[model samples]
Target: MEILSKNLQLLHFLDKEDMAGFWKLKMMILKITSHSWRNWISI
Candidate 1:
């Protein structure tokens, strides 16, 4: 039972890390897309 609980805690920690990475990737994509659109409009 203790091992199972520890495993659950580890999973939770990994999930949080994954979420942070996901947000960072999303922001990068948004920034790239917006920059492309601006360049497109200028042309």
Candidate 2:
């Protein structure tokens, strides 16, 4: 849920052809997913 919101925020912030923004957004999404998975495993 949080990840989805953050992803939407990133998409809203980034313009087309903004490679750096895309890269950052990608990394943020990956990190968020990884974090979520870790949390689920710990629970």
Candidate 3:
């Protein structure tokens, strides 16, 4: 459900060609994934 909303927001951003927002979102996801990976490795 949350993923759906994020997808919709992503679509809207792309429609507006919001590169800064898109890049920010991309960086946020990357940061989250990397953080999760580090936690998993620590365990």
Candidate 4:
């Protein structure tokens, strides 16, 4: 039971980190797309 609880805690922590990474990736993509849009507008 103790081992199972520890495993659950670790999985929860990893899930949080994965969500953070996912958001970061999304922000990066947004930034890139917006930057390209600005360049296209300038052209």
Candidate 5:
């Protein structure tokens, strides 16, 4: 039971870390997409 609880805690921590990384990646993609669109329109 103790081992299981520890594993759950680790999983939760990893989930939060992944969520943060996912958000950062999403923002980067959005920024790149918007920049490309602006360039396309300017051209």
Candidate 6:
């Protein structure tokens, strides 16, 4: 959880630095994690 939060902070910082790539990467990560969470909950 700490690592995740740190990574999220890094992503946010990168988003501020380079909006386009950051937005794309952020969305992709969000989609992947959201799907994983859903699957985990279902199990």
Which of the two, 2 or 4, has more lDDT?
Answer: 4
Task: Give one digit per residue, the lDDT tens place, for model 5 in 1-43.
Answer: 9999998887677877798897999999999999999999999
- How many pairs collide in each candidate, listed in order? 0, 0, 0, 0, 0, 0
Candidate 3, superposed: residue stretches over 4 Å from native? 1-17
Error of 2 at 9 (Å): 25
TM-score of 5: 0.66
Any runs in candidate 2 off by more than 4 Å, and if so which? 1-17
lDDT of 6 by residue, 1-43 (tens): 9999998888777645588876889999999999999999999
Candidate 3 colliding pairs: none
lDDT of 2: 0.90
Q: How far is 31's C-alpha from truth in model 4 (Å)?
A: 0.3
Q: Which residue pairs clash within candidate 5?
A: none
- Residue 42 shift from truth in candidate 2, angstroms: 0.6
Task: Judging by TM-score, tell me the better candidate of 3 and 4.
Answer: 4
Q: Which runs in model 6 stand beyond 4 Å of their true positions?
A: 1-17
What TM-score does each of the candidates earn? 0.67, 0.58, 0.61, 0.67, 0.66, 0.57
lDDT of 4 at 17: 75
Among all windows of 10 consecutive residues in model 5, the one with the lowest summed lDDT is 8-17
**Could you give candidate 2's per-residue lDDT for residues 1-43 as a string of tens digits?**
9999999898888677796777889999999999999999999
Q: What TM-score does structure 4 among the candidates reach?
A: 0.67
Candidate 1: residue pairs that collide: none
The window of 10 residues in a row where model 1 has the poorest summed lDDT is 10-19
lDDT of each: 0.91, 0.90, 0.87, 0.91, 0.91, 0.87
